[model samples]
Target: MFNSFLKLTSICFALLLLPISIMAQELPSSSLYVVTSCYVNEGSSFLDAVEEARATIPNDDNAANMMFFRQPIAGTNFEKNQFFRVVSWNNLQHWAQPRSLPATQEYSCDNHNRTFHTTRVVGTNGNTAYTDTDVAFVSARQCMAKDGVSLSEVYDWVDTRISRGQASRQNDNTMVQMSHKILGASPNVASGRMITIRRIGDSRQGYARFFDEQFMGTRDRTLGALPDAPFEFCTDANLTESYIVHSPGRGI
Candidate 1:
């Protein structure tokens, strides 16, 4: 009788831990992102800034991907001529490799840098493939998990909604990314919070269609409905015009 009880207890414990082990294996590997916010110098146009960035920035084997996001001045906290530069690595090990930047005086901008651990929640863009002409309309916002809610729980909730086909109006070209601040963020944003970025389309027309679908067509009330979502996202979303600067397989 004693031996049977011991076996039963051990089996129950193993069963309880089984789901956790499976979830761990299913979790996607995260990438590291180095994001820089900058303001172009007075009298310098965006074209000049882009040219300077293309010439100076590292697009070597270590860097996984790079992008430039043009921030709109109206209805945004950003100053005039403000933009963002984002560089990503496959993992922390790759990012730790010694990479040097060549000296260049052509790039003129006041910049602040931050690092993040970014994970993909939906879509297939893993930040790997891109073309020079590919343009994306991006919407980013800060979010905080609710009390007793874990990050994995939030990911599971999003995954469930996505599986149900209620996540977004965009097609397969869309990508939803969640980024946790590893180096920098405002004091208002707590450490438990994360930044969510949604890339709507490959072009401006795709973004327009998204809005039209939201207002004109049937609304997706189930995407982030309360009682279903484990976290809450901020209402103030920053929209930007994103352009691919460098990608691995694509020629610069």
Candidate 2:
């Protein structure tokens, strides 16, 4: 078992260094993301599960990047020992490539329950030095477009928010990503919900400072009110401890 694990790790490492060519597709402006929830088996530690999952990363050139997130058990509806793995693809055509996971004692994840998101970054603070070991705080929420509001208008609202944060000097280490569900469970597909993800800082302290500035400092008053609501996002946001398990040098 030890030897097999080492072999798998080596293969994955090699694949990680390979350059992924951007595939020719109709939607060159965005990338496809697959988010999968993983549950660690009883008696297996989260670190063990992470190592096991890392060994199974797809080697195809279509696979752009992969990230692992440890979901908080408290204040969330996730089951115990739940983690998330998000994979990025160059295009939808490459997503059709056959992939499977080998049985593992550390954890079990079902690819079928995966949610597909078509994502594009709407705002950033210009800090792009992303690495595999970098840790980040993510706040995700589901949103629905307001009546008669186009998707572009919704994105413009997001941009305006980022601009406010920038003016207040509160978004130096933040990135805002907007995603639309292309394929997923019935509820998500039927609702036509959009996902807003805010990746704050490269470490836990960054998140701490962000909140402190928002609540304790005077910056909040200067940021100004939000523009007319272009989308109605859920008030309850899902927070996660996101870790970059594998980064392909492209800034997220």
Please provide TM-scores, in order, for all candidate models, with all chains considered together: 0.77, 0.75
Residue-level lDDT tens digits of model 1 in 1-252: 999999999999999999888666445667777777666677776666667766666776676555564555224667667777776677678767888766534344434445555656554444322223556676766667666666666676665654454244454344566666666666666665665644445566665565567557766454453676666655556677766656555554
* Candidate 2 local lDDT, residue 177: 70
What's model 1's TM-score?
0.77
Local distance difference test scores for all models? 0.61, 0.64
* Cα distance off (Å), candidate 1, residue 205: 1.7
Pull out the clashing pairs in model 2.
none
Choose the strongest candidate by lDDT: 2
Cα lDDT, model 2, residue 47 = 79
For model 2, what is the C-alpha lDDT against the true structure? 0.64
True-vs-predicted CA distance for residue 236, candidate 2, Å: 2.6
Please report the candidate that would top TM-score against the real structure.
1
- How far off is residue 46 in model 2, in Å? 1.5
